[model samples]
Target: MNKGYVYFLTNYRRTTIYIGVTNNIHSRVWKHKLGEGSLFTSKYKLTVLIYAEEYDNISDAIAREKQLKNWHKQWKWNLVKQNNPKLEDWYDTLRGW
Candidate 1:
């Protein structure tokens, strides 16, 4: 079975946030950073990965992404903070994965 990833992205100012899921987190994030991922991400410059969760099933990853998207902004922020208290970019962690 294929695995999946659900991730949270924030802009440099940490004001904008985006939630997404993909089978390839590294490639997807690379596209977003290069301004070729999604219109919303490119428009908002949401390229700093703050949080990510792995799932054995792609369906669960998609569902979690949808659930996070529907959550309140504050709730989403809290979730990110819970995982990444410093809110630092985590793109580097994708290396060797």
Candidate 2:
């Protein structure tokens, strides 16, 4: 099965948030962490994966990413807190993938 993902990354202090969708979440996040991803991610140093959701379809994942991107900062904060109250860096958890 093809998998898609919607994920969020933040800086060290959780001061910045980036929402994106990718078919290969691990690879995509790795690239971002290594500063080999988009200019925005690299410039902002957003390398900590704080939140993620998996999906079976790319379109749905893309739509969710777009929706989250347009949400207000506070709304996004609540969403993240619901799943990850501490907003801990999830990079290690994804390493085995």
Best by lDDT: 1
lDDT of 2 by residue, 47-73 (tens): 999999888888889989999988999
Candidate 1 residue-wise lDDT, 3-79, digit = tens? 88999998999998899999999999999999998999999999999999999989999999998889999999999
Q: Which stretches of candidate 2 lie over 4 Å from their true place?
A: 95-97
Work out the TM-score per prediction. Answer: 0.95, 0.92
Off by over 4 Å in 1: none
Candidate 2 local distance difference test against the native:
0.90
Worst 10 residues of 2 by lDDT: 88-97
- Could you give the C-alpha RMSD of every candidate to the true structure, in order shown? 1.0, 1.5
Model 1: how far residue 58 lies from native, Å? 0.6
